[model samples]
Target: MENKYEDYKNEIKEGKRTLNQTRKELGLPPINGGNTEFINREIAFCRKIQERR
Candidate 1:
């Protein structure tokens, strides 16, 4: 049987999902001003994914 964690990981690797989405899935709070680094990284990742499409 496939593990849910591995499935989620694949979704992220394929650019089908974002960290913010995963955060919400896990019931975690969304990123905010206090997490500038996370915001910058996720934004850059999203841009890269968009550029490929």
Candidate 2:
């Protein structure tokens, strides 16, 4: 089976979708504090994965 989380990550990495869009698709609530620490972490993780390739 395919991994939805990984697919969403790829979408973000490829600029096919925004972090908020992915979050909504994943049934997650929007961040209210304007603190995107989690989103930034995920983006950083994606960049690392791309660099490894």
Top model by lDDT, which number? 1
Those runs of model 1 whose alpha carbons end farther than 4 Å from true positions after fitting are 36-53
lDDT digits (tens) for residues 6-30 of candidate 1 = 8888898999998679879988668
Query: Tens-digit lDDT track for model 2 on 1-53?
Result: 66988888898899999987887877876665776887688789999999999
Model 2 segments beyond 4 Å from truth?
32-53
- 10 residues in a row with least lDDT, candidate 1: 27-36
Give all TM-scores, in the order shown: 0.51, 0.53
- Candidate 2 lDDT at 23 equals 77
Winning model by TM-score: 2
Q: What's the C-alpha lDDT at position 35 in model 1? A: 86
Q: Over all chains combined, what TM-score does candidate 2 have?
A: 0.53
The residue pairs that clash in candidate 2, if any, are: none
